[model samples]
Target: MNVETITKTLNSLDQLQRNTAIQSDLFSIEQTSDLTVAAALVKTLENLGVRYAFGLFGGGITPFIASLEQSSIEVLQFRHEAGAAFAAIESYFASGHPVVVFSTTGPGITNALTGLFAARWEGAKVIFVSPCTSATQRGRWAFQETSQYTMSNTGIFTSGTLFHYATTVECNSELSEIARRLALGVGKLGGFVAHISIPRTIQTSLLTTPLPHVNFSPTLVTAGEDTISKCLQLLCEAPFAIWVGFGAKDAALEIRQLAERTGAAVMSSARGKGIFPEDHPQFVGVTGFGGQNSVLKYMQEQRPLRVLVLGTKLGEFTSFWNPVMVPSRGFVHVDIDPEVPGAAYPYAETFSVQSDIGAFVRAILKYFPEISRSSSVLPLPRPEREVIKSHLEGLVRPEFLMDAIQRVIVENSDAIIMTEAGNSFAWGTNILRFAAPGRYRVSTGFGSMGHAGTGILGAALARNRKAVAILGDGAMLMNNEITTAVKHKIPAVWIVLNDARYNMCDQGMNMEGFHNVDAEIPSPDFVMIARGMGADGIRVSRECDLEAALEKALALTIPFVVDVIIDPTRPAPIGSRINSLIFHGK
Candidate 1:
C-alpha cells in the first residue's frame, strides 16, 4: 500500500478507536500529579494496562519514572539501556501486556535497537520510547537524531518487522492521535510498534494545553462469516498440520482441538514453545535449530496437505522460508495484524485472514473436523534409552548434559529455563521441556551471546521464579553481569555447557578442512568466578555429578551457576543456512 493509503487506514482506525468507549474511567488522563509530558505518557500506558516497565530512565524519562513509582506500576531498572529494553521484551512475551522501555537520547537510544530487534522477532508487542533531540535539535546534528519509523522496522531480529506498516509519533499536538494510534496499531498490528522520536523539547517543556483524552480500547478482530466458512471448508479438505508461534498464546486450546479434530500433528516455532503441551502425543515438538528428527521425519512422510499457521511468521530459523517441508498447498495464516500476512510467508499460496489467532481458532472450532482430545497421549516410546544414551555419552559429554537437563526439568513440576547461544542453544532447543507459561527464554532469532545470563535474570525477576540458563562456555564470558544476578537477588541458575570453544564455528571450520582457528576459548573455572561474584557456583565434570549440581543450584534461593565441562569435538546439528554460510562460503 502507498503511504497515503496507510495514513487513510490509520485515520479510519483512529476514528474507530475514539468512537469505542474505554472499558473503564480508569483510562482517563485527568490527573493532578504534575501533568508533565512524561506523566501524560505514563497515563497513556496505564490506559493500555501496562503491567511491567523496564529500562533505564536517567534524563528524559524521569517525570514518567517518578510517576511510575507513585503509581501501582512496578518498574524494573536494568544495569544498561539494552538490558532494560531486552527485559521489557521478556516481560511482554511472558505476559500479554505492553512493556515500557524509557531511554534518553544518543547512546541510550542506539543501544536499545538490539532489544527491540529481539522483541520484534519474538513477536512481542512492545514500545521502545526514546527521546529525539528536542524540536530545537532538528536540522542540527543534536544528540540522537533518529526517525521513529526506522527504529520500529529495522528488521534486525526477524523479517516480520517490515517497513510498510511502520509508524512514528512526532508531534505532541497529536498526543490524542498518538494514543488512539497506539491502541489500534500496537495491540492489533501483532508485532512491534514503537512510540518513538519524542522531541526532547516537547518532553521537558510544559504542555501549552491539556492533553486530549481519546478512548482507544481495541475491538478484538474476528473472522467474517464467509471467511470462517471458507476456512473450515479448506481445513476439512486437506491433510493439514498446525504451526503455532508466540501469537498462539490465546489460541492454545483451540489449536489443540483443531489439531485433534483434523488428526494434524501440531508443530510450533521455538518462540511458541509450549503452546501445545510438549508431552502431547500429537505435538511434533518445535521446528528449527536442532529441533526433532522424529517430528521432521513425520512431516516428510505424512506430507501435510495444508499448513495452518496461526500467529506465526514461520521465520527463517524455520529454514529461510523453506518449501520442501511445508509446500504451498493452501496455507492458512490467521493473524490479528494484517501486516504479518503481507510481509512474511507471502509465498506459501496463503490465505491471510485478518482476525486474532486465538479468537479465530475459538470461533472456527464449532466447524472443524472431530478428533479426540483425551484418547490417551502416546509418548514417543523411549528410543532404546540406554543404547542412545551410551552413544550420546561416548560421542560427547555435552549430549549427556543436555539429556540430564531434559530429565531434570521433566522431573521438576514448574521449571523456568534459559539457554544462551552456540552449541548449548542447539542442545537446549532439542532437550528442554516446558511445563507452563513463562517457562523458557532462548534467543531463537538473534541468538546473541551473553543473553542467557542477564536474560535469565530478567525472566526470573519477572516471574520471581527459578530458571536454569544453559550457557555455552565461550558465550558466558561476554557480559559478566553476574553482578546483576547478585544485585537483583534473582534465583537465576546457570548451567554452563563448558566446551571452551565456539563449538559451532569450530565444527563448521573443521568440516570444511579450514584449520579451525581462534574458535577455542580458555576453559575458565566458572565455579571460582561465581563465588568471587558473590553467586554460588559448582562444577560438574562427570555425568554422575550433574544431578547433584542441578539439585544444589535449584535449592539455593539466590543466583547459582553450574559449570558443566564437556569435550569440544562433538557436533550439535545446526541449520543448513548456517552450514552454507560456514562451509560452502555462501
Candidate 2:
C-alpha cells in the first residue's frame, strides 16, 4: 500500500486500541464502591497522568487533600498559594503534562491569580482545584466563601480571562463532564489551564453511577494537498529563512532537517531556544530580549525572499513588530491556533496555514528531495570570541556570571536551567546555550519576577534532575520559595545575582533619559537567609570564586543558594528593549 493508506490504517488501529483500553479501565473502576465526588476527581486526574499536586491546605479543601493522600499522586504543600501555582506551571513545562494546584476559597484563590496568569501567558497545562463554601452557605458570609453568587461576586474564576475552562461543580453528577473537559483541555495544543471549583457539600456527595470513560486524543492537523504544493514550490526557490517559536518545539528534528535541506538560515524566539541547536551553522541567533545582534544584522543584509514562520504569533517581544524584520516578500505562517497566523502581521503579505507544526513539517519532508547530504548555506561570521569575552570581564558582570553558569551546565548536561524576569533573564538567554529541548525555561510572556526561584522546585521534581534558577536580587527577595525546596528536599540551586537594584527598570530609565531614585535598593546577604531557612548557602564576591561556588552548589544533595555580588554600575544589555519601549511606549 502507499504511504497515505498505511498511515490511515495505523491511525485507525491506534484509535481502536485506545477505545478498548478505556472501556476496560472503566469496567475495572465500576467494581469499586469507595468512590465519592472527591475520590472520582482524583481518579480522573490520575488517569490523565497527573503525578503531582502542589498547593496549600485549607478547611474547604480538606476532603480533596484526603483523597489525594490515598492515591499515587504526591502532594507538595507550599507556604504560599502563589508558590504552589508557580511550581505547578514549571512541572507542566518539564513533564509536558498537566499538574494540579489546589487552593481553598477566598484568599487562597485570590493569591493564586498571579501564578495562574503566568501559566496562562506561558501556555502551560495546569488544573487548578479550589474548594468553595458549601452551596447551603450562600449569602451568609461564611468564612472564606468565594461563590459566584455570593456577596463578593467572585466571578473572576470563570471570567474567561485566565483559564481555558472554568466551572463550579455544585452537583456530584458533573464529575464526568469535568473529567472529559479536563482531558480535552490538557490534550489541546499550546497548552491550557483549567479551573474546577467544587463546593464543600459536593465533595462528600456519593456517586451512584460508574465513572464515565474519557479518552481524548488531540487532532493532528496537516497541510492540505494544495497548501503543501504551494509550500513546496515556494521552498524550492532559494533565498528563504525559517523563524521558529515555542509552539514549534515538538517538531525540532523535522525543523533541523528542513533547514539543512533547504539551505535556509534559522532564527528562534527566546522561548524557542534549544529547539534548534543554537551552535549549528544554520542557526542565525535568537530574536527578542537578550538576543544577538548578529541575527538582526544577517536579516538586514540577506533580506531573504520568503520567511517561513513556524508556530509563532511573532508577538511584540519577538518581532518588536518592526518593519525591518518583516522581510520584503512577506511570510508563510503555519500554526495550530487558527487565529495566530495573521494576528501580528496583518498588513504584510501572508499565507496562513492552520496545522500542527510537526505534522506539517513531516508532510513537507515527504515531498522534499532526497539528497546524499545537507547543503545549508554559508553561516554568517560570529563576533570574535575575544571581543565578546573582554566586554564580559569584572567580578560581577552579568555576562561573566552567565559564562560560569554555562560551564557548570555543560558539565551536568542533564541539569535544567530556569531564569527569572529582568537582567538575569536577559543575560542568561543571550549568553547561555541549551543543546536540548525543555532544558531551558523562562517567563517572558508574563515577565513575573519571582517565577524562576519558586518554579525550580517543581521542575526538578518533574524531571528528577538538578534544576538551576538564575534570579536577580530584587526577585529573590520578592518571592523565593527556598523554604519550600528545603522542606521537600528538592535538588534546586539558586544563583542569585546580587545587584541590589531593580536593574532592568534602572537601566531602562537611564536609557530613556530619566532618573528614577526608587530603582536602587539594599541588597540582603542571601547566604544568611538561605542558611536560616535550612539550606546550604555560599557567598561569592570575587571573580576567581564564582566557578568554585557554582561547582559546590551543583554538587549538593539538598537545596543550595549561591549569592554573587554583581556590579550595579555595569548596565544590562537591553538595547532592543529600550528601543521598543521608546518607539512603542509599551
Candidate 3:
C-alpha cells in the first residue's frame, strides 16, 4: 500500500468523533491506479479503521473484493444487496464503528439505497462506493450511465439540507477531494457519506484533487440571537419537560444538565433511548407507543410549562403529535434544521429555533439568567409499572431475570450489548447503561427486522467486543445471519424472546376484532437453529434457567443463542393502549 498524505478541513470531525462509535485519528486521501483504484479504496478503508464492508461482489467492486478476501477486512456477502447494506448500518449503530459498503454501478447502488437511507435516518457513518460505466460511455447508452452528478444530487436527500448537482464530484482527480469533504460530514451531517465512482477510465483518468483540509463554514440559518434569547428566557422561567430525539445526540451534555438543574422530567423517543440514562431520577422513560409506560402517565399530570426538544425530529412514533402522549404545553424545538419544528403538531403553539443543538444549549446556560420555577407535578402512580412488572414476572418468573442479564454484562467487563428493536428494545434499553464507549449498539432507525442477527455479527467484527443480541423471535427470522456469525467465529449471545407470534402486530390485530391469522408464528426451538448454524444455544422455559445459561454462554468464546419464552399477551405499561390499538381498526 502506498502511503498517502491527507488534505481537507472538516468541522464535522469533532462532533463526529464524539457522536460516532467509529473514532478515527488518521484517514488517508488516497490516489488510485487504473487497476489499483480497488486496492486504493481498500487502503483508504483500512485508514478509516474499517474491518468489514457489506454488499455483493460485482464488476465495479471486483478488485476491492479480491483484495479484501486476502486482507484483514472481511466481506459480508448477503442474499440481497439491501441486507448487506443494512448489516453495515446495523453494525455502525450497534458498535459505533464506521462501516463500508460496495455495489455495482446501477442496480447495486439502487439496492444499497435503503440501507444507506437507514444510516442517514439513524446517524451511522457509512461509506458507499459503486462502479460506474466508463466515462467514454457517457451519453451513448453504456451500461448504468447517467449524468455525472446524479448520485450526488440525491446524496443530500437525507442530509437535512438542500443539495444541488455541485454536491457530487466527477472522475478520479476529484475523488479524493470529494471523499475528504464527505468524510468530514460524519458528525456534522450525522449520516452515511458516499464516495461513489465508476471504472478506472473515470476515476484514475481525472487529474484535479481538491484541498483535503478545506473547512466548511457553518451558518446557523435557522437560529438568530433573538430566537436563542427567547428560548433561553422561556427555559429559565419554567420547569420544562425534556424530550429528546435521535437527532438530539449533539446536545447530550446540555440535556443532562437541564434535567439535573431544573428537576425537569426527561423522556426520549424509542430511537433516543440512550440520550439520557433511564436510571437518572430526572429521566422519565421513552415517549411514544413503545416508550416506558410510566413516562406518559407522568407527562399528563405535570403539564410541563415548556417541552425543550433538543436536536430531535419529534415524529409520529415519539409524539404521534398526540396531545395525550406529549407534554401539553408550548414546545420549543431546538434543531439545526429550520423547517422541522411544529411540523408534527399543526395546532401547537410552539417556539422553535434553528441552531446547532449543543451550541444553543450552551448559549442558554451561559447567557440566560437563572430564575425560580415550580416543579412539574408527577403524573399517575406506578399503576402500569406494578402491573407490567407483575405480568413480566408471572410469565417469565423471577423478577431478577432481566436484572440478571444486566448483572452478567456487568460481570463481563468486555461485554458489548446489541439489541434488535421491538418491545424487547424497551426492556433492553431500560435495563442496560453504558459507562464506556463501544459497549452497546442497535440500529433503530431503519428498524428493519432480521437485522439483529447480522447486526450482532458486524458489531462483533468491528469492535471485537463480546456482543450480545437481544431480539424478538420475529426479528431474528428477518435474516438467518447466524451462519455468518458462526462462520466468522464472532460469538455473541443471542437472546430470543419467543412468544410464537408478533406481539406488536398481534396486539394491533386484537384491537381490530380481526382473527389474528397472520401474526401467529410456529415457535421455533432457537437452540436447534443455532446448532444448525454451527453455534451453541439453549432453550430456557423456566426463569431460573436463564441466569445460568447466559453466564455459561458468555463464558464460551463463540456465538450462542438463548431462546426465552415470553407471554405475548402482555402490554407494556406506560402509555394508553388505545393509541397503539387504534391502528388495528378498533
Candidate 4:
C-alpha cells in the first residue's frame, strides 16, 4: 500500500472507534458536530438542569423524545397532552429546576395550551418543545398539519401572552441562539415559559457546528439602596401590616422576623397560606376566595395605617379589591413585577417598590431597630379554629375530612399538599393550617379544574417523595395521570372528595337563588379505577374511616388513592366566593 492509502485507512479506523465509543457510553453534550439538531437541543436542556420531560409522544416528535431517552433526562409519557403540561409546571416547583413539555402537531399543540396557560399564571419555568410540519409539506393537506397555512403563527410560534420567548427552528444555525435564549429565560426573575417548534426535517439534520456553551446566571431583582431606604421610611411612618402572597414564599423566615419585630399583624392570600405560620400569635387570617371572616374583622376593628404588601397582585381573588382590605393610609407594595404594585387598586395610594420578595424583606429587616423586636404586645385577631368531630355512621363531611388530613398527612408526612379548584380549594384554604412554606400549593390564578389531580405525579417524581393532592370527583374525572404514575412507579397519593356532583356549582347556584341546575355527576368507584390503573386504593363511606385510609395511602410505596364519599348537602366555606360573585354582578 502507498503512503496516501495508509493515511486514509488510519483516519477511517479512528472514526470507527469514536462511533463505537459513542454507542456504548451515555450521550454527552461536548459540542460534537456528529449530533442531530434534536440531540443537540436535548443535551443543552440537560446542561441547564432539566431532569424530566413530560409529554405524549407522536411520530413528529419521536426524534426529540428518542434523544431525551438517550440522555439522563427522564421522559414521562402522559395519558393526555394537558396532563403532561400540568405535570411539567409542578415538577419545576417541586424540584426548583426547569422542566420540559413536548407535543406533536395540530391537536397535540392545542391540547397543551390550557396547562401551559396555567404554567404561566402560576409562575413556573417550563420549556415547551413540539414538532411542526416540514416546509415542503405545508398546506399540502398533510396529516395533522402544523404550519402557517394551516394554523396561526401569531402566539403559538411567537412570543406573546402565551409564551415569554418562542421560535421555530427551520435550520441548524438557530440552535445556538435558541440555547442562549432558553438559558437567559429560565434564569430570569419569576416565571419564564418558552416554546421551540422544530420541523420534522430539521430534527434529524446533522449540526454544522457545535451547540454554543451557555451559562445560566439567575438575575435576582433586588431593590437598589435608594428604593430600600424609601421603603424603610414608609414602613416606619406608622403601624403597618404585612400581607403575604405565594410570591413571598421564599422569604418566610424573614417575613416572620419582620412581623415579630414590627408587631405587625401578618395575613396571607388564599394561595399564600403557610408562608407565615398560621398558628403564629400575630397571624390574623387568610384573605379572599375561601378566606376567613377573621380577616374582615381585623380590617374593620384595627385597620393598619399602612399595609406592607409582599409579592402579591392583590387581585380580586386575593383582596376582592374591597375597600375593607384597603388600609387607612395606603399600601407599601413590593413585588418583582413592577406593574402589580398599584394595578389592583390603582385609585388607592401605594408606595410601589419593585424587587424580589425575599431580598426586599431581608433589606427591611436590617433597617429595623433592636427595640422593635419586643414590640408585639397588642391584642391581635386570630383565624377561627373550628373543630367538628366525625360522626359514627354518616357520610364524610368535608370539614371532618380536612381535620383528618391535617393529622394524617399535614403533621405526619412531609408530603406537599395540593388542592384542586372549587370546593376542595374552598375547604383546604379555609381550614387546613400549615406552619411552613412550600408545603402547600393551590392554583387560584388560572384555577384550572384538574391541575392538582394531574400535577401530583410530577411533584412526586421530581421531589422523589410523596406528594398528595386533594381534589373533588369532577376534577378527578376531568383529567388525571394515575396510569402514568403507575408506569413510572411515582409515589403519589390522591384524596378524592367524592360528592357525586359539582358541589361548588351546586351550592353556588342555590346561594345565587337559582334552582335545579344540572350539576350532578354519576360518581364512579375511584378505588376501582385506581386498581385498574395498577394502583391501590381505599373507599371511605363513613367519616370514621377517613384517617385510617389516609394513613394507609401515605404508608404505601406505590401510587395510592383515598376516595371519601363526601356529603353533598354540607356547604363548603365558599361564602366569600358567592359574595364576590354577587358584588361583581352589581
Judging by TM-score against the true structure, name the best candidate.
4
Candidate 2: give the clashing pairs: none
lDDT of 1 by residue, 1-586 (tens): 2334333433343221111222422234454335666667666777777777777776655655777776666776776766776667666655667777767666776677676666666666776666654545555664445443233335421233431123343555556666665665455545554645465556654544455554545566676655665676676665677887777776677777777776777777776777887777677767776566665666666667777888776666654454555643757887766666636555567887878776788766755536545556433321022223433242237777777776666466365777777777777777665644456667777766766666666666667677677878777786546766787687878788787788888876666677838887788999899989888888877776777777778778877888877867667766554653554344
Whole-model Cα lDDT of every candidate shown, in order: 0.65, 0.81, 0.62, 0.88
Relative to the unseen true structure, what is the C-alpha lDDT of residue 85 in candidate 3, on a scale of 0 to 100? Answer: 70
Error of 4 at 269 (Å): 1.2
Q: 365-479 in candidate 2: lDDT tens per residue? A: 7656544443564556442232234233466666777887877775465888988899888888888887667788887788888889889989999989899899999889988
Candidate 4 residue 426 C-alpha distance from true site, Å: 0.4
Estimated TM-score for each candidate:
0.81, 0.92, 0.77, 0.94
Per-prediction backbone clash count = 3, 0, 19, 0
* Model 4 Cα lDDT, one tens digit per residue, 151-219: 999989999999999999988988988888888887777899999999989999999876776765455
Determine the backbone clash count of candidate 1: 3
**What range of 10 consecutive residues in model 1 has the weakest lDDT sum?**
16-25
1 against 2, candidate with superior TM-score: 2
- Misplaced by over 4 Å in model 1 are 1-34, 57-64, 132-174, 197-204, 211-214, 327-330, 339-348, 369-396, 435-438, 575-586
Candidate 3, residue 111: the lDDT equals 69
Leading candidate by lDDT? 4
Q: Residue 4: error of model 3 in Å?
A: 56
